[model samples]
Target: MAARDPGASVPVRAAVARQAVEWLVELQSGEAGDATRAAVQQWRAAHPEHERAWQHIAAVNARWRGAAVPSPLAHAVLLDTPAVPARPLPRRAAAKTVAALLCAGGGAWLAHQATPWREWRADARTGTGQRRTIVLADGSQVSLNSGSAVDVRFSAGERRLRLVSGDILVSTARDRAARPFIVATAEGELRPLGTRFAVRQHAGSSRVDVFEGAVAIRPRDAGQAPPRVLQAGQQARFSAAAVADTRPADGDSVAWADGMLVASGMRLADFLAELGRHRHGRLGCDAAVADLRVSGSYPLADTGRILDTLRATLPVEIHFITRYWVSVRPARR
Candidate 1:
């Protein structure tokens, strides 16, 4: 099998590493289905890198086995007991303990890889803590917020984008072909009229904020009412049934494209929730401090640094249960 180039992009290398770890964990689980076995076989056959990665994992496992302890009691002790009372483990038992550690590590990696894997493979996407801009074939520009994904399709009559998840800011160019520019989300469709706008998709609704010109929002099932036209500085949210009342758009709405999260007297919980969109895993605050007001502009690129700034500026303490699990609480005097 040919080895993968060491200089491959970080995301590609990380994805392959996760796949290798997942395969190792599944095979060790002893309950891998026939389908799982077939999938792994297909994966190895599809790419030489897959076989190379599997070989590396196998070599690591062999090394662990060679240094393992002999006694089962020693394995249990090493796994469950504290290190202060160090005890020499038989070689066979130590091997089993190493294998168990490897399995646990693989399980943890799988948990971390679950959420953003789809976005990682999207046609156009931004990873957690990443923001990017893409220029379409027709000269239109789309800026993706962190953890966002969008699929673009240009046909003879229309320029369409499907918002699979997260948020995007679109600046429509004058289409020489005169194809209408449209963005579709689960909730509805947004048609831009020579406009610059932002669209965000939530669990049950989609929001459109027009920065310039106008956008026509049509609910997915507009039974009675006609499409709503939102002019510059207006924003509205809609579900499948109806469009909400238009509200004044805030400058903060498009600040994310500039890598800044701008907040003005926003609740601590709401601010954290928005910030979490650019991050991975769970990031919340204790209910006790949920109502506290926050006002600032923070860089979205480094969430850890943003958290550090919050801890320094606010009367809150940051608690990290794990790198993936974090919370903020009222600081103790």
Candidate 2:
């Protein structure tokens, strides 16, 4: 697509590592028009990492381009879902094509795009930037946030919902079986008291906010320790070991169910982390502005507009190397 990086010093990350391969696939397919070429030129100048990643992919792809299949790289990445060919890419060529992306420290992020059995096999799952609502057999409604998944199980004694990944909002339905409704995460289980609440599964802990009624937090490691009961208007996070102290619940916890993110005196880094969940790829805030306070009610569907909002109101600049790679830095003074 574009020439080598020449010489640029920047870590390849965000979508640069992934987008580079897609651009190469387009060029190698001999279908890229003049417009596509011009866009590639502009993308190369977007940031140093973009150039570096583009060059690296082209360089490595050259090594595997002459395999048994004539168009191995073209069909391998399936960049943003390119046109399907009459024939599928062979396993040998496909592996090498994916290997092209599994380079540098960014392999983890792109690798996530591959098969994630847990999320894929989940009974209910939402893709990046998407949400879903499913009605259970007992009429209970569960709402899944972006990049979320859940598995529903019912038994004679309990109505159980497992949070495989991401967050969920539960609206319990009175069951004819009269079973207690419970939600489980990696760290603990939540038993709702005929009320509506939101549960978020984090890396090391699980957070629950009681918007309507009380709930009990039972940590997996809480041997003789009784479950912590959280009343309405309270929130708590718990690990397998113990539950943290309760705090005043934020009404904004359920706002995502309505497609909005509400921030009130929230740190910029925290704000971006929440917003990033509704988006694909990376949305990072520089440490320099990490603690800056932000307050607003932003729509989840228009993440780009939210970034534009920060640029207009805060002392910040938004750098967009690609649609999938964006960063927020202090405004250049």
Candidate 3:
């Protein structure tokens, strides 16, 4: 771990905050090694806030590290396997079912790793940098993006998910006609009465953006709570201490699942701040030039080229402190 630059000013800390997002992005793409641990240690030592940021990231991963790699919905779809009945499944049979779904390992061992056997049949998920789509036995499709996790449990009452982290886009397939689909996050739960929607969990809160159809949100800890319903072209942000916040839904917000970043006349700083989530190194801007605005569709697959394009079009500079560390500042002023 490296020591913090004692003389570093506030701007430097801001730059690091931006860099930290990128580090998190990279860490998700692969396993964090010794170098990563050292970097985290150094970031933690830099300032108290850095430690908080790192802990938030670490906490998200810790939640899923040992959890079972869920079997994809594809099993029930492509394979034409019937839904595991809602009734209590025998332990040995359930293990086989889970193992069959993951295909990488056996279910018995994984079942042992999950906590609270009751929640065992509950929904299971993967974490950041992971993408998976499952077709439920009933034909619904679920596609999850990186840094996201979820647990699923379907019964006569509802199709539920405990969203651990990240995001998911779901298009319900015809299931038993009327069983509602619900997704729960720290902030609240989204129950889609209609067919398609996306749910994302972040910073102890959750956001629901519906592209088509309607969904209802209920905070997990609330008793007899009246859930707020959202229809197409609408979005909602929910948290523990706050009532659900609803607003117009932006079509572009869900573009990341397709590996695209659609920025609509966004500030250069803000765009970079978002881009930092997909790149591996630091991304900073000259404080003087940070306010410049940018608009376009950038491919998340080539973040380096995205930076290069920024340099060509804007009056800004890109600095690479290391292959994994980059900083954007004023054009070498």
* Cα lDDT, all candidates: 0.71, 0.73, 0.60
Instruction: Summarize candidate 3's per-residue lDDT along 108-182 as a digit string, tens digits.
Output: 322332322222233544332335687776677888765455677778877776766567888876566577777
What tens digits encode model 1's per-residue C-alpha lDDT throughout 135-244?
99999999998768888889999999989778999999999989999899988899999999999988689999999999999999997678999999999999998999
Best model number under TM-score = 2
What is the lDDT ranking, best to worst? 2, 1, 3
Which RMSD values do the candidates have, in order?
14.6, 7.8, 13.2
Residue 278 of model 2, lDDT score: 84
Give the 10-residue window scoring lowest on summed lDDT in candidate 1: 76-85
Off by more than 4 A, model 3: 1-130, 241-245
TM-score for candidate 3: 0.63
Please report the candidate that would top lDDT against the real structure.
2
